[model samples]
Target: MSFTTRPEITGTFGVATSTHWIASAVGMRILEQGGNAFDAAAAMGFVLHVVEPHLNGPLGDMPLLMRKAGDAAPTVICGQGPAPAGATIAHYKAEGLTLVPGSGLLASVVPGAFGAWMLLLRDHGSLPLRAILEPAIHYARHGHPVLPRVAHTIAGLAEFFETEWPTSFATWLPGGKAPAPGSLFANPDLADTWERVLAEAEVAPDRAGQMEAARLAFYEGFIADAIDTYLRDACVMDAAGGRRKGVMTGQDLADWQATYEDPLSVDYHGWTVWKCGAWTQGPTLLQSLRTLSGIDLGAMDLNGAEFVHTVTEAMKLSFADREAYYGDPLHADLPVSTLLSAEYAEARRKLIGATASRAQRPGHIAGLERWAEAAVARAGRDLAAGPGVGAGEPTMAHLTERRGDTVHIDVIDRWGNSVSATPSGGWLQSSPVVPGLGMPLNSRAQMFWLEEGFPTSLAPGRRPRTTLSPSMAEGPDGRQLAFGTPGGDQQDQWQLILFLRLVHGRMNLQQGIDAPLFHTAHFQSSFYPRATKPGHLMAEPAFGEDVLRDLRDRGHEVEVAEPWTVGRLTAAQRDADGLLRAAATPRLMQAYAAGR
Candidate 1:
């Protein structure tokens, strides 16, 4: 047997895996208490908001893939909120901005995480609203051990929080200081906010009524009022180095609600992989899978330079398409059908060569040449800049900047029900805390382009093409798999590698997650100061010197990362025989997988 950081948890009952140990435990507890995977995933998501506040929050965005027992295909639960009615390119231009700031008020979107969780729990989940929220409330009201990275992030931003965003300072820095690492830290205000929602929800008689009441309480009632009141006059420093007020309003919240949609899928090697729609970068993974289907990845050494180069090159092509064409399907006419077609993949696959390509090359769809041209032009621009207070996402913390990231959860109950969710945005550093609400609003609007005529252009009521992607698939033998990770742009990249290893190399869950991972920054970033490094690749040093040298020789701008620092992936799967299995990456020693 190959060495793994941890054993693949096996059972017939249930399994829960998450970026944080506490959240995983919370999910497992839900499963133990007779909740299905949807219920368990919802509970874990709320707990993640409390425990990994720096990574995700109650006001963030989540895109989840769920498969109910006996369902042949997974469905998408789009928790991604849209740009507010007032968030238009004209308004942003009037504010003297070229790109949407990565952090602060101007980048705020309608908080969607809470709505999404509620939607999941209300429709598919079997638990009461209170039961799903109790774990998070307990952690938030009492306290939980602060992660070292969270402490470090707070310490780095202490001065900024105190001077520029006092509300945030009051919420994150209690007693006039950042909490020490491993110290118990609590967000009583957050607890209060949820408790109030629960109180309002319980006023309704039954489970269905309670869920509806909770949704109203959050979107049309107190939560919306609080956010609207806060953003009304709160202009603050943003990534563009200016003080700006947001365009979001209570009406935006009231008008928006999480919705369910069909997931996009591509068949590869008899395995049908599912992902969220083009609204997210989810289809990039699907596109990459299609592009690589023509290659013999199973014949290559999984950890060798050839494998890394081919995958990275394929991802570059796919992400290039993401920048050009992927956007809110509700607002734009996306060429999704053509993009996922086999002929398109065959045409794109021919672009990969022995050497790296230093160009952003989106495919030539007849009527979409302008969008492709805009993407290439945008990529060539030198928008690289230093990180501002709320500049980047957490997964990119490895960068010189102290950034925040997203969190992921995978749950599979004994009945074969499963969910894969990636929850992110609304980092503590993203904006000031809404006065009484402990959580900050999301900065997801940073993903939109200030330019006009593009698929991802800034417009009111449009969903920003988010990088938050969760994945699901059915193997040849009818086994179901649910998996995802937390890196912003690297989310799909790492997942692709893990899935390929599982499909081709036949590695077990733990072994696949434990394997060395790499990702390329060849495409434009989805954050503030959207920078692009044409041939850049970051890989874990565990790939060894020979492989690294070979990659460098192939013209990859290889940057060796610290051992096991590349990805924080977690996965769970159920076999045809009814056996359940799960695994999590040991990269940060924070992710965990729990099962019977």
Candidate 2:
């Protein structure tokens, strides 16, 4: 029933990913060639935009956090854009808005990738921006396989081909059509942007200037003005708005701007973790992980009833916090101080059972009595599922979820330093195109609370809480580990479970990442809904009633998940001798790790 936590090995390790394994290989080469972790990670983060445009783009938001071995202080950066100060919650209310098309388009925030990446390089990277960007530039110009995931998403959104702003896809396509998987694709416009970023980095070589150029090229240039005109002219968004109708006006493009800033995070059970601040649901991940820690997770097998019950109860406890206090930390007085406190962790842990899990959370923390009451009031009720529900028909149950635009790259070098990063190309599927620019305007403005006066409502310069969290963990023995995922809300538990599997079960990086995973949406704010209820677990349907019985004894809802239900992307442990291993969920196609 007990699993032992093993010590982490030492050596250079790196994990970087593009939608394609080629980019992943490129980063591994950099690491082996003696580039630091940041350089390796930056290479992967930039190139994914070229190979996986439909999922992520240069136009979207980025949230990044990192820590070095034995370093008490951790640095955090936000890669997400902000709502224009002009975009108030009042805007949605005034317009009688029911929904916004893409979360990236809804974004009023300024894009922060330029600044965030520089900060990473400035502190952790060894090579110059020029050196780090070389790989991406090559990939952008030369091209790689049209991943099935990428091709499918773009084909589904073919309307984008006709949108007001020029799509870079056409440039990559050459024949003016999507290339089939395995066909070569290239991005000339992004190549130009890549050149500009490199030129800026060469000229100023400072974080502020280099990053600002990256921002300005997309926002204030011919691209931005045209898109502004289009949005103003069109009023409504669709493919024809650009090429056929000429509807979106330059004025609308002018109105569009990417947001930027350092998003907030908190410690759960004394370990540093990241969240998607105000606009997106990031804190819910932190709260659930902390709550889960209180239970005796090893009481049953990984898929057994007891394990499921304890996990779900903890999820319910944390859900209360997410629903109540999980908003932009700056906009409100979240009880984060108390939520992560030892007293609350212990209190939250006490409500679980080895037999049957409760379908709800307990008001264990004193300050959260109000939240507890609310949960009690709403007990047995299900929080509404967000957009993109019932999208499992496509490959990997990700038709909606896999419209992915975020990328994660983590690196640890032989020098005992590590870097964790998550970057974005604005959501290609939903963001509007400015007339001249090939990039899409971020639509994260939609992540704001649709209702009036919600804590996450848009305001001047306020950052949207996002699911784009990049995190690093250090073992109790000073051995270091870092990882992040693209699964929206599952980023938290998915990464947490992976970390625990390696530490608690002593699995290697691949085995740990490849292992079956379970989660409970009950009472928790998931990027996806359809939470597990009492007596259910989203597990491989291989375990027997004995496992379920044990979970019931602990008050869990253990449901059978299709085997291989989850595996978010990961970049960790730099060298094989070290922990630098890349682990994509086995469920995902063509995901693997490479290190030298």
Scored by TM-score, the top model is 1
Q: What is candidate 2's lDDT per residue for 225-301, written digit by digit as tens?
A: 55556555443342112111222233333444333344345554444455445444555556666666655554546
Candidate 2, residue 431: CA error in Å?
A: 1.7
lDDT of 1 by residue, 432-523 (tens): 89999898988999999999898899999999999999999999998899999998899999999999999999999999999999999889
lDDT agreement with native, every candidate = 0.91, 0.54
In candidate 1, list every pair of residues with a backbone clash.
393-404, 394-404, 394-405, 395-405
Q: What is the lDDT of residue 264 in candidate 2?
A: 48
Q: Estimate the TM-score of every prediction.
A: 0.99, 0.79
Look at candidate 1 and tell me the lDDT of residue 18: 98
All-Cα superposition RMSD per candidate: 1.1, 5.6
Candidate 1 differs from the real structure by a C-alpha RMSD in angstroms, to one decimal, of: 1.1
